[model samples]
Target chain A: MKKILNNPSDFVDESLRGIVLAHSDMLRSVGDPRVIVRSDAPVRGKVAIATGGGYGHLPVFLGYVGQGLADGACVGNVFSSPSADAMLTVTKSIDGGAGVLYLYGNYFGDKMNFDLAAEMARDEGIQVETVRVTDDVASAPAEQMSKRRGVAGVFFVYKIAGACAESGASLEEVKRLAEEVVINVRTMGIGFSPCTIPASGKPTFEIADNEVEIGIGIHGEPGISRQETAPAKELVSQLLAHLTADLDLVPGDEVSILVNGTGSTPLEELYVAYKEAHSWLSQKGIKIFKPFVGEYATSLEMAGFSISVLKLDETMKALLQAPVNTPFIKQL
Target chain B: MKKILNNPSDFVDESLRGIVLAHSDMLRSVGDPRVIVRSDAPVRGKVAIATGGGYGHLPVFLGYVGQGLADGACVGNVFSSPSADAMLTVTKSIDGGAGVLYLYGNYFGDKMNFDLAAEMARDEGIQVETVRVTDDVASAPAEQMSKRRGVAGVFFVYKIAGACAESGASLEEVKRLAEEVVINVRTMGIGFSPCTIPASGKPTFEIADNEVEIGIGIHGEPGISRQETAPAKELVSQLLAHLTADLDLVPGDEVSILVNGTGSTPLEELYVAYKEAHSWLSQKGIKIFKPFVGEYATSLEMAGFSISVLKLDETMKALLQAPVNTPFIKQL
Candidate 1:
């Protein structure tokens, strides 16, 4: 496979260094711990927000670190969770007088490592709270909401919780808000083709030319089913059906919708999906307050789309509309 | 030729509709105008900011509309400028009580349409000012800065000027700051493979398997030259050499850098380019602040990257650091 690099193994480190160099005024790297934090971090009396996940998903872990999002982010190898040691290091760096909150996805490796890191931080006298985002309804049975996998809906939790943390909310309040967001959110995805893993220099999965996968996870995990190609409107129907069934979304329910394009799905197709989705939601009498389309989060080069719905209330709406500045998400 | 689209003609319109539907709380469409404006527009006496460009560069034109960035955006067809009528409608809808400012890249079609719209706005008793972002050093001779094409550097102009507008700067002040940013910024790009336009179902340009095109423009415009594949460091050196020489950048100068990936470049490769770029800039004693590496602005599925540098001053630095809440850019 053709790539622009000196060595594949050096990809993540070099990229992190470049991010630091680019945003030196706003971010810094801890040498021993391999954590990326805001240059003016450890805001005294403010609850610290920390998130870590695999590399590859730019602006998610790294780009989301700034004034109103994450205070620090521990990055792991591509699609792999950071080690407990790494998370602990980041936790220590951003821990001020106020406690630190660990907010991340519900991926198994991340759960394992972050759990260990939280314990380590507790031993070090730093109060820590954990909020796992399990917004992907496709990943688990409707009866077990906690078993759902996390997808891009984690961004909403980060935004709301991060805004609360920046507003000097206590760790308890921030954690409560984050958990509330997780419970009210649901996502479902479809994949058209597989992406290439840089290290392997091969496609992550085999997808035939005339087929698409429904209910695929972001990390290239096996999808729920493979089906023949269909029109954009039909695809939207299938995705929305899965998400609405899982959430049991009723008429007149207010929601914040996000139609995310997995890397290779052009804005053209994404918009087509969005058109149908908006109509469907409207037909159901659902009021979508804040709808985010385009690629807020993505799996590299995967041609597909995902739909996420966050049930919104007045408090959540205000928080969602709060002004924030991060490398990736900014809402004024 | 693989795509998830049902019809080609409906692509741009459908996408715009989706954006409006998704972000209805934040944005609304002007009746049949091909413009998307913030919901709480005509903000009393605030100066309105408007920008326009072709579609396909998701989050560039549409994503930058919100509270503190752009008041409205006029979208064109894929890689094509919006009609003059569209621009005029956008200008009218976003013209706050104070006035309206026109900001856009220096593409021929966009310039023509915006210029016409500015005249129309003036005739309608609206005070209008214009700033054309010309930062692609590859598009013109070093002695003719005004002749350079506008590429990703337009984003910097959007940022600094947007902050100024948010702070209640006069139209003249906003235009002045935007012009200064344009004058100080420079960008150079390279494409390894051509992007396939969805409607055409063909590559925008031809590149041999082992070939790369240097000095590529954002719209698949022909590059300065095509050359054999080179290492990341060498490729970066060649692009930077051209940009810095054109700008006459001196040592000890500080600049905000962006290593932007065209749609299809893997993060791994982007980091490789960023590594060499950071080292080169540092070796020149240039202080890099807020280095951004990602698909901030893109060119469909083109396998390429662009480097944008904005020479910074205290004002520019503050503006860069200012909080922005747009779909694509969120700098706190």
Candidate 2:
């Protein structure tokens, strides 16, 4: 809660300026209320990809805007969606002759704002398509996976769709690939400690000292259930059970796994969880293409991790393997 | 403090396993010890570049190993150097036919270990070279810049040297490029809070509620001095004055600036510092090539920031602009 910020209102604006300055060679900002984008954005014949959300996730919004990822990103305040106007600016800035594709997580505020922006883009006679990633199975029943809330699985959509776009794919192809990734991906999170919002200087959720929550959302949302702290292997098994059960993953299935740490978890513990998870999947005869275990998506300083599995095929594999040069993700 | 690890001793090994599992497509362990290299390392005839250090700094030792950066990295326990055996393993794994180049910071432990490893490699009849990055102006006088401790400036060296290696440069050429980057770069850090080592479960240093320290090293090391908290602009000015005074800066010199947060500092505060720093540098007629503001190199859970300035020439500029695909550094 003791944040070194000047003012809560200026947080997003100031952070954006710094991001632009630091990555000026690779990225730039557009318009007055800046939206981040690659320095060479609006690729003449390629579909422009833009995604945005709240600002607390550093490498997510700004860090992800570089080569082989989003061409532009519109960031909102911490844990809040950007305004419709802000999205509109980003959309316009990255719209090349091939049109633009909007890819983002499926959160309530973000959904509404992106919808409004899409309508505004239509009014401006620019071709625009949208793909809302709803990959967190904890948010909905298995049969209604499309209605689930999005979490870190949105990263997969970004990777796959961005690769398609960077390869000069049409907006329709980029949107389709993004949608496919969203459908094939699933994510579930756990939080051991709650993080304090910088502006409020208060805990976002009440987590008991010795307890951990399974299936927690990234933004301090309530999870499926709470349980006592257990060994690393047991904790990973519990998470994997829920994730695999929700997706009905079977033996010999090929998937890409990600063990993402919520902000405060150390790399040491993350690796422990990954070790158990990798063994568990291997025991099930699952073929993992590339597993990413790090603090990809985080919630302020919360101590926890999330397991995301994206079932991969040849195309998804190639797209994932494509060279991506971004502040956070680097695929060679 | 209160780490989520099972045992302190297993930290590095377990974390390395998790990284390999997570990035199996991109990276793999070099040998039995704590060395990680790109899955497709030892690029035919290019100089193999390697770096290693403590494990607490994620994205620094391991996160920086990918295309356009290090060919391999050895990780030790938190805030400790890897043993010579570990460094030797990495060097052997990444030693292409062209020989190997080791680039790292100027910490005593690291220098001693790397030197021992270099000697061992030489005994094995393998060509080897080393470049110690010592760019912290706060640690040495201008005339003794080579004796200064290395910090975040090592990142610049990794980038430039990695680019040279990728271009099939000889071991000597890569070492020269890395040394040149170190000479042109200078960094100074300040700390507002101390980080707790996971093994100790307590803070590395103590600071009063109203105190901040300037010229702090990344590992919770005691800073040059402590002072009352000041405005972000004032803090940036103080740091810039100390860092830039020793370097020869004319009215219109071009430079690349990095305002790095030491983990706990919020992105918002970093931007405030960047805003003031950018304005001040521009006012001095310094042409900024690209300004980077983010948590690049961090002290675990420490609340502070560091500023690094690298005066640019055509080679430095091109290397900075080169496309790099790494977990942390992404130049597209």
Candidate 3:
């Protein structure tokens, strides 16, 4: 296998061991080894944010469990959703006095698992709310907006909601803020290569040497279209077009941009992509409030990048600029 | 080309433009566009630290320019050293009233360019010092330690030295601390895949699909041997053996470890590597002070990971715990 590891089955557990060993100061595992929470989780008066997802896409689900971010995360095997049992364990561990909000991608499996867990938590007399992020513009049409699958734009949702929760917001208020972010953020990604699942030892998808998939999913699901590989400038322009159209963005609008790299793409390449996106937005008279260029979500060793834009309001702008501290990312 | 870029020849300049666009608050281009300094340079009475090298390695040369890190960095073409003129430009822009230290990797071209820059800056009447980090144990025999090249271990050199400089330490004290870190740190890496330079559009090296290169340099240079890829446990064991022996680390000694991905490798894999390293060290009775697992240094999108251990004394441990804020890395 091209990937590095011990036994394929031990992939997730070994990586968790590494995380526990490296960031013991900020994270801890609970009833289930898969359920990880902040060391100081369950802050007395603050609403808690719990996120869960499959493995492989790091910093997405596990990396977000820290200060100023998600309070807890339950991870499953590579590209597989965690069990409802694990989700319930995390809910019980991170519920502060205020309440707990389940924030995650709009995937069928995750939705099912988290929903089941939330019901169980409610039975336990713990208040719980749910807000699924549907930010990937290509996942669905505008009419079926809720059908959209979340992608890199979940970063903005996490940041805005984390900030609100950290400020001692009520569960209702935090859920509202998170939903608002989900409605405003749109993402479009292009895939040049696919990643292998350690357990399966098989590539998620395939592409010709001269082809690229536009609007590709993180799991390598078929995108909107496949075309000949093109320069970053053209691809970014098309991605922005889809994103701006999806958000109904217009001139004089201010927004924040995140040009994220799928795994295996060099950081320099991501900057190259950002340079093009910045120029495109500038030429259109769109004011960029804050520009983030890095890898927030990845598909193992897949290659390519995504451009996400959040049409920001005054409230969103303040939340976006606030400090964020996590083992995988920090803005201070 | 398997890269997200515009004109390959514009690789460096475009990336620099993107960097300036994204991190304007933390960094700025000096006289030469390639020479970048902190937004607030020359911190009155504090010693200034200037580091520089080629492009492609994000966060290494330029990513370290901010609070609790280097004050300025002059970047060059991909994997190529910055010109003497560019280095001098950075030195002039970031020279605080106290002095400036020229800290960088021990590469032939870089050594020559920075040495010449230091001379020119001295002639201009600004006090200057130099410290070359030679921490890669695989680059040379123990007896020829000074000939070894600097690799990911440079992160420790920057951290401890930057903390010292940030504390208003004198230029002499800062240089001493930097040299001390360079002496105590040792790194070893294994390369699984080669990277392609954008300008050339050619892979740096070639290896059999099933083969791995042990002791590979950051630039894809040949290592001690090429053999069939094995489990993470075996590779990490061999790497730690070289590092602990070269650093003369013994039982009961405290150390900080950085399991660095050489681009392309997934963060999960790096953590898996860290888990093995932690177990190996703990079983040997060695105590771990801090652990960083990520892409601190890279070679474009090369696939590999390096283990860097910095033997820690009380002073070094405290320094390592200090806060660090930069465009790419934050330790707060």
Top of the candidates by lDDT: 3
Give the distance in Å from residue B54's predicted Cα in candidate 1 to where it truly belongs: 2.4
For A1-332, candidate 1 gives per-residue lDDT tens digits of 55677666776787777667656777899874348998888889999999988887765787778887889999888788999999898888898879999999888899999999999999999999999999887788878877878888888888889888888899999999999999888888888878776677788788888888888888877768888878777888888887777777899889988888777676656777888888888888888887776666777677788888898889899888776655555444
lDDT of 3 by residue, A35-151 (tens): 999999878888999999999998888888877889999999998899999999998889987889999999999999999999999999999999998988888999999999989
Superposition-based RMSD of candidate 1 using all C-alpha atoms, in angstroms: 3.4
Q: Rank the candidates by lDDT, best first.
A: 3, 1, 2
TM-score of 3: 0.99
Listed for each candidate, the true contacts retained, as a fraction, are 0.62, 0.46, 0.70
Give the interface RMSD values of the models in order.
Answer: 2.5, 3.0, 1.2
Q: Candidate 2 chain A vs. true chain A: TM-score? A: 0.97
True contacts kept of 2: 0.46
Give the TM-score of chain A, superposed on the true chain A, for all candidates in the order listed: 0.96, 0.97, 0.99
Docking class of 1: acceptable
Off by over 4 Å in 3: none
Ranked by DockQ, the better of candidates 2 and 3 is 3
